[model samples]
Target: MKPSPTFEERWKRLTSRARMSIPDDFPELPPAFHTRVLAHWQAQPVESWEDLLATLGGRAVWAVVAVCAIAAGFVFTDFHEARISRPELEHVITLEAWIP
Candidate 1:
């Protein structure tokens, strides 16, 4: 196998391939190019939560919120029913009746 090149040899090989000189007489950009770029940047609409909701429409947002509230209501009612019908409470009541 061939040995790896030294650091100096590697650096020189890299630099020789990248050697480029800029010419003294580069042409200037047109004045309108700057103003056009600035105007394009300024004309861009900044988006926020309100803009996002507006794009989705008020009715769609309300529908999603209503669906979530319904799901939450179902979950809460089931949890409450489970808590009320616990077997441990019935067992405790039966034990108290036997003791008394």
Candidate 2:
């Protein structure tokens, strides 16, 4: 029985046969080459940090929303006093735990 071809041998044969017998505008590429060509075609210029920051800064509503959200989180979730209660005679746990 014959051994199956290795990936490199199969790819070379596939690509060699797949090339334009009669050249048309488009031909299918090998899987490896497809990603590179697609990436090149899809590439765009990236925004700078300052440009990003400026865009974020322009939205006054987000700044207000962020501040209010932070304020609400601080106000609502914090325990003003310990929920647990124990006898004072046992040298009971003081409110010092609540200070921080």
Maximum-TM-score candidate: 1
lDDT of each model, Cα atoms only? 0.86, 0.77
Give candidate 1's TM-score.
0.33
CA deviation > 4 Å runs, candidate 1: 1-12, 19-28, 57-100
Pairs clashing within candidate 2: none
Model 2, 1-100: lDDT tens per residue? 9999999999999889888475786866779898887787679557789988888876967889999999988777765645554566333445555444
Worst 10 residues of 2 by lDDT: 89-98
lDDT of 1 by residue, 6-95 (tens): 999999998876775444677888999999989998899577888888888988989999999999999999877746556988989999
Model 2, residue 51: C-alpha shift (Å) = 8.9
TM-score of each: 0.33, 0.32
Candidate 1, position 64, lDDT: 96
| Residue 30 shift from truth in candidate 2, angstroms | 30
lDDT of 1: 0.86
**Over 4 Å off, model 2:** 1-3, 21-56, 64-68, 79-100
